[model samples]
Target: MISYNIFTLTNGLRVIHIPNNSDVAYCGFAVDAGTRDESENQEGMAHFVEHMIFKGTEKRHAWHILNRMERVGGELNAYTNKEETVVYSSFLKEDFERAAELLTDIVFHSTFPQQEIEKEVEVILDEIQSYKDDPSELIFDDFEELLFPSHPLGKNILGKPELLRKFKSNNAKEFTSKLYRTTNMIFFVQGNIDIKKVKRVIGKLTNDIPLLPTYKIRCKPLPYLPIKKILSKETHQAHIMIGSRGYDAYNDKRTGLYLLNNMLGGPGMNSRLNVSLREKRGLVYNVEANLTSYTDTGVFCIYFGCDIHDIDRCISITEKELKKLRDNKLSSSQLDAAKKQIIGQIGVASDNFENNALDISKSFLHYNKVEQPESIFKRIELLNSETLLDVANEMFSEDYLSTLIYK
Candidate 1:
């Protein structure tokens, strides 16, 4: 069992602390701002700021930050997504305070030094170039642009190269000042620790954050169209992605969608997509589907790669199977298997330190409280064949946006 509590600090920062009996300690700050909050010209500033935060802070150099944490056997990292930016650290329970202070310092005190910012910009540019080289990454980004043509949801998290070229030290500093304010941040700590102490530390750390304009931005819906895009790339296999908009992260029906995704392609060995496409017909090398849940909107996608000659056949077969789920009845045994798979995955997630943080923190952000993990199990257990069919029909409903990219 986990003991947890949450409180709003005097500075308007919400902090959630989860206490474990184990020796490992982990903490993170989830900032409720990301690409969706960016201006058209500042597309990837959230991600860029995450990189820049580690470059240097007002009191410590980059190497000093690394060395100090390393001395205590602590690990620190940060990441930016479409809706949030998370900076996290892990260390022995004895080193929790040091780890927390270092994380807070980097995120709250980054100076965005002129020399370091120049070097980091080049690094991000090269990272963007590297993604362009990887067809899998490029195709998904293309699929998103294809699916949501006019929305920021479609924009790449890595801001466009041309816009990034114009960014300098001052631009990053200004953006960070505006984006990383205290009101938009939530501090989360999970491990063997005192709840009162956790609250005290966070309150003390964020007390002086300067006030700024609200960071929350309402996510706009995607304009789905019956359009197809094919990018010509010289590669051995054609990487194809088919996707459409789906439900929001907080939607009640998401659990059903999770079960549906598993039945379609995520049941591992027994999944229909893999069994029929890869094993029976042998038309493609591999097949998979994903439901990416986000703050205000979500996406359901099926992706695969095949020999150039097999592209058309692969797409046709994939569509047929997707439609089949809508048209056919799911047997009780099949539904049971999918439920088991999802439950097992959730069970694994329950014990994971980082994922536990993700599960609780995400629930708090989305539902305004952490959902008991058992509640999910009970929901899945109650899923009958009839309910399964209903969910499948609703998920693969008539409205869908598709994107395809090939060599």
Candidate 2:
């Protein structure tokens, strides 16, 4: 079992410390600001601002910041998602203080130099082009575009190149100042250190975050209506993705969906979709399903790539497999197999302490507490075939799923 302690700063930055026997520590800030927080005028601003954050800070130049942990053979990295921005690092256990101080500097005090912002805009624009060049990957974004047609949730994180080019330093500063509040952040660390010491370090590092009068409030958008779209592309193979809006992270149905998705098409080779679509019929080379849950909504999708000539047959077979899950209740033996398989998969994945820290931080952000592995397994075991079929009935209903195809 993983044990952790929590601490809060005077302003509101929550800190989590998980002690481990490992020599390397994983620590950083998990900011609550992301793409969905951007306004219409700032389509790509969240992601753009994420890139500029490392450009420079009030105390440390970009180069110095880059080498702060690297000099000690550690790494500093960050990423932007639809709902959060994470700047984290993996460093030697003794360098925990150094890592915390540097991360605090970047997240709270980035100076966003003018020249750096300008250059990064061109780089991000290039990124947008690279994504468009791959139809299989691009189709997922296009699918969400159709699903959440008028909402920020639908906007690609790599915003429009034209809009990105016009973003100035102050623009990023304004977004950061308004959204990156002490009240909206979490400091999570895992290492071979005393819990009290970790708390003290985080408290001191975040002692200066300003206390804003109001919190950033993002209203949940209306649920998406199902829609199908076709994009004609000059590509070597046809790609298809179909899915419906799924239960949010907070919903009870989410656990069932997690198991159902894996049985249908998870990382393992024996997944129903992989076995039926590739092993037996040999319709396509790549086929998989993914489930993503956010604070207020989720997107579940199945993507497959095949020769254009085999597209119709693939879709037919895919629907047949989904129909089995939706209409047929699993036998007791089948349910037990799936439950044990997923439990083992989760167990194997939990061995990575770095990923464990990241997941724990995100869980705290959402549920305000981290659930132990045993509790999670209990919930998974309690779910019956009826629960899974019920979820499949809703998530796999033809009326709810949308299709986006690139051919």
Candidate 3:
């Protein structure tokens, strides 16, 4: 039910705006570059650049960048993933120009001073250490390493400390110059602003960016091999992850798998995994399923933390649930209920203007158009129980699924 506008600047940066009556505005850039784009030697450069971007720019110091929006009661933030990097902000609607200009400055004009790089690397090293301390969290990265094997997609987004220390300002600048082309970026805004004004503001500032040719091509991961691994770690509870390579973003069956994943172990308390593992049996504290689909491949995983004594029981129960989905089609009432649950969840999530803005930016970046909620709902509605069963059988087959455990 949301509406938006999109246009391309002469510099090739695409812009999208979602009209709303809210007093707060959300704006940012979604660059079609991320961890996977880095060369082997580059390692953590993408994420390092994200942190240093706000440290200093041509016109502003780190302190100035931090206070520019806060002085106006706004917030700025950015994150990098396997395939994309997003820099965004939330501020009062009237300060749209201020937020947009600041985002532009940080993304394109950041100086990435050595002082900032040295300080930030220490911070990130601490972050990497903290991540290692949490098995439940670190297990996901290990699971991805198993899924993608030696490929860049499998490497942790937080690069190694040794490589991180070697990164210089020139390395970051070169990476950005090579990958962050105007054609590979999208400026997204959500608020009560006019699209024409957004076009004018972004167009004038970005006009100086030379039109550059797109040169990045992502190499897909090798054929998946189902591998089972258990690593010993000192922890109070055993963490388990089991899943397989799944349908990519472009697959027609992706929607069906999404619904199936929701019914099995989504956030809802009534999910089959939660009901069977937690509410009924009291076997574990939490259980959840996650599906991450990228440009050319996807990862579908279920993670649960349980006592060492309960690990086998938990795995058996999880496999049993997967078997149920693969062996039996949902009844009409069950299918309808599953569809409603996910649709309602999506509807609730769409109310967050910030997330919606970021989502549309990525959508436009990948698919070149924003799909309305109604459109997504229609696709979900078109999915049938047989389709869900087929996807479950294919994606959840024992031969395809891999298991990783931290004990």
Off by over 4 Å in 3: none
Q: State the lDDT of candidate 1 residue by residue for 152-263, as single tens digits.
A: 7788988887887777778888876776776777788888898878877777777787555555555576455656778789998899887777677777777787888887
Ranking by lDDT: 3, 2, 1
| Candidate 3 per-residue lDDT over residues 1-407, each given as its tens digit | 77888888888888888999999999999999999998889888888888889999998999999999999899999999999999999999999999999999998898999899899999999999999998989999899999998888998998999999999999989999888788888889999998888988999888888999878978989999999999999788999999998889999999999999999899999999999999999998999999999989999999999999999999999999999999999999999999999999999998787888888888999999988899899999999988888898899998999999988
Which model is ahead, 1 or 3, in terms of TM-score?
Answer: 3
Please provide TM-scores, in order, for all candidate models, with all chains considered together: 0.94, 0.98, 0.99
lDDT of 1 at 327: 83
Clashes of each: 0, 0, 0
Regions of model 2 farther than 4 Å from truth: none
Specify the highest-TM-score model's number.
3
lDDT of each: 0.79, 0.88, 0.92
Candidate with the greatest lDDT versus the true structure: 3
Q: Candidate 2's residue-wise lDDT over 1-407, tens digit each? A: 77988877778777888888999999988888888999989999888877888889998888999899999999998888888988999999999999989988998899999998888888898899999998878888887778778788889999997788788989999999888887777889998988877877887887777666435777786867888887889789999998988888889999999999999899999999999999998888889999989889888999999989998888888899889999999999999999999999999999988889899989987677999999999999999988898999999997888988888
* Residue pairs in candidate 2 whose N, alpha carbon or C atoms collide under 3 angstroms: none
